[model samples]
Target: MIIKPMIRSNMCINAHPIGCAKETENQINYVIAQKAKRGTKTLAEGGKAPRTVLVLGCSTGYGLASRITAAFEYGADTIGVSFEKQPTQVKGGTPGWYNNMAFDKAAEKAGLKTKTFNADAYSDECRAEVIKQLKDWGAKADLVIYSLASPVRTDPDTKVMYRSVIKPINQVYSGASLDMMTGKITQASTQPAEGDEIPNTVKVMGGEDWERWIKQLSEADVLADGCRTLAYSYIGPSLSHPIYRDGTIGEAKKDLEKRAHNIDAALKAKGGAAYVSVNKGLITRSSSVIPIITQYLGVLFKIMKKQGTHEGCIEQMERLFAERLYTADGKVPVDSENRIRMDDWEMDPKVQDEVNKVMPAVTEENVNELVDLDGIRHDFLIINGFDVDGVDYNKEVTDMSKIEY
Candidate 1:
């Protein structure tokens, strides 16, 4: 029986379970199509195959993509650890849990091994439980991917609290067009991050948590030889520097980059490596809300897609696994900034140069022609399978209660 829709702020916060399931299948199909285009020679090569992978922040975005890559691209047995769970009515909604269920169903259909731990990744108790579960399965992970984004975290020891904020570094106010109704950009102001916010932002969003996860795994002896760990970052065009790179969040990313190096050093004796891959921005539930970013991404996506070079989160992850991280050569590529450079192509000077030429002129009147705003918006809705084509959005979606990790 389809469930009756619940009203929330005059908008539908509910998702159709069947639609979500179909969306997951679509993503799997996309991976297969992309692989075919890239050729099988570039795919992850394995004789016995790594049986276990631990993917933190596997609820959405890069983390979810990483899990799919491990299961589909490498045929690894996977365990996804995330705080997201099926939302009870009192607790609001379960966007991540439903997505996970869809992923699990698709993976099972493909004969891939999968499990999920719907618990907080930052909590010691949760980590202990995951380690115990792995030990019970008589398995250790050959790969770990940390891709968490949270606004606040309490130190496990100090119990001190930290909150993340995104602001610009300079005293500048920028204009952007925002959808007043949806709070999305149709196209207003992006301000600079305050100087003092930089260090604090880094402390919160950077690599400290990533390193902690690795350390815990190593201490538990759950890390396999030649294991690799990756965390995702973003480096957009210069136009967003004041609001992103030089902003509070940028400071956090810098801290994250530094944390990767520290993690690498700690793992050296164990023949493990830690890396931070700079990833391209796409329309995600998180990225869409950031000021000015929506407009810029809309423009960028349109330009890149037309040139036959655009990539969504899944595409980027597939390439990261096939072309860079797991390549046969054993060499990880880095850019001039001394970090992994997957996002470099997205921010190519020529591309950004062209984007800049049109950004200032992109008003609502000419937005469709100048940018892929509709595509960007559609991707956002598609994240939850709300606005996808061929899906019956009007169908009563009553299975929310059954979605589980």
Candidate 2:
């Protein structure tokens, strides 16, 4: 079957395998070219690397970029766990599935150790599988990265499925938003969450899963001495606080941040540490669907690009590891909330002022020329293997869904 992008509601249901592979390669290349602009030479010209590293949600966005950086930057052996759909005769696999396949193939060609578990990362069985992989590889992980982002999570013990809400709290949130499906800026609003929305969102997106992973890994003795773990989170500027920072997802993020201390103490007992990194806003499948975020990002991207302060997934993760997390003295600098703030650039006063000036004035007519809609839109599509540079769209793409990784 020939694959073409079928998009709806800021999501592309279909993905091109070749384009997916190409996108994956592009991310990998960014890490490999350490001598380029903002050249990060953390690794001693690729002398030594991490013995073992595990990344949950290692398929898309920063999670996938982290995986590539771990292998390509630090030369670390990696094991990934993610829940992604396999393609069928009539459907295309989730972009992550193809990305993992491409990553594994590339790792093999480069003679790098890489393994992936295509299962629910929130399950006991998946944890067991990771522990088994660690034991089989004869190396406990020195680094563990949790980058899980799911709309729903099933409790392993109670077998209860909780879906997370992204609604604002207290009152309806109205703001300018960029419609990703079309090149238009529009007014977007989200009603305050209903009963149990906050609790449910926390239950689904909170740090329970991160704690579970750390606990299970610690119990299995898969964490090396002085091991470091980090999970991705977001705290955009005040513009998106209603639907992001102070909204349902914000409640979930608060829970996640609170758990960091617990995990840090737990890991400290084993000569290890854990943290939550509040990341910069970028166009991702998850964030694009959120209310009023794309418009914010559109304005943000334009400002940051002009200021030469823009950082994508690879750049952020690269900096996190090279400059922040694993520094010369091993001291990780964090904010007052006891979490790393990679969104520092985004939260800068100058940048926020620029965003605020143009946010309220955003309209369908001027959004294209005024903001970075083209750049933001392309990032969304390229992640799912559409609108990619140098990808042959005219050629027939064979619908070979599964690749043994």
Candidate 3:
């Protein structure tokens, strides 16, 4: 059947298999092109790069981008962990499932070693399987990228599941939310967190799972000497602080940042380090439904594109590896808080000033002129395998399980 995007409440609920495969291939191609342009080399060429890498939540968004950059750009053998449903005879699976298929197929054709597991990353069993795989290969992980984003996480110790919420703390949040499909603006409000909601959000989205993964890997001796680890975070403009940076999710991120220090110390004892990378905002599956993020991004994208400094997931990850993680002098440059700031360009004073100026004047009548409504809509659809280039959407997809990647 000819597939189209099924969008509701600014979220796309369905994905096209062929479109997903093509999009993954696009990211892989971008990384390969960058590798050649930047003159990056493998460890055999006497250049600095990770030999063995592990990526948790390695199937979608930034996680998948990180995996692609590591394997295609740096020639690292990668072990990926993500939970995604498989396609059935009647229906296609999640976008991440198709993306993983494309990635694995591309990696095999390129002769890059990879092992992808479809299991919960928040579980101890998943960690054990990764460790066992590393031991079997007689390889140790030198780079571990933690980029998992889930609304729910079950405690590995108690088996109790916790869900995360995006509510603000101590104050009500009211902002204009953009409907990417209809371009209709509506007033969206969320009450402050109450009744153990903050703690529960922390339990689901915080750093405990990240620390657990590191400790288990270190204990199993699956970590290489000078091993480096990173967890992705975001801190947008202060205009979004009330709903994002200072919200319940923000509290959870604080825990994530604080635990980075503990993990850093533990890894530092063995010539390793841990860091939290604050990444740029993009139209992701999770961010699309946020109170003000969609509207904010529409304005931000307009100014950034005009300035010629716009970046997507693939662009950000490539720059992170080429500039920040691996430098010529072996010194990783970071902010005063020891965190890599990939959002530097997005938060530039000039860019933010334009965004701040344009946002307040935006209305339904002039939204297209004031904001990148077309750009935002395209990005929203692209995340779920729609609006991608070089994909024949009119063609029938007979099999949901296969794609020519």
Off by over 4 Å in 3: none
Point out where model 1 deviates above 4 Å. 1-14, 33-50, 88-92, 170-172, 180-187, 190-200, 336-338, 403-405
Model 2 agreement with the true structure over 1-69: per-residue lDDT tens digits: 556688887877778888888888888888888625545443445433456789999998889888898
Looking at candidate 3, what is the lDDT of residue 391?
91
Clashing pairs in 2: none
**Cα TM-score per model:** 0.88, 0.94, 0.99
Per-residue lDDT tens digits of candidate 3, residues 1-94?
7888887788788998888889999999999999899999878677899999999999988999999999999999999999998997568899
Give candidate 3's error at residue 173 in angstroms: 0.3
Q: Candidates ranked by TM-score, best first?
A: 3, 2, 1
Q: Count the backbone clashes (under 3 Å) in each candidate.
A: 12, 0, 0
Put down candidate 1 lDDT per residue, 267-305, tens digits, no spaces: 778787888889888876556666677778888988899
Instruction: Sort every candidate by lDDT, greatest first.
Output: 3, 2, 1
After best superposition, candidate 3 residue 133: deviation in angstroms?
0.5
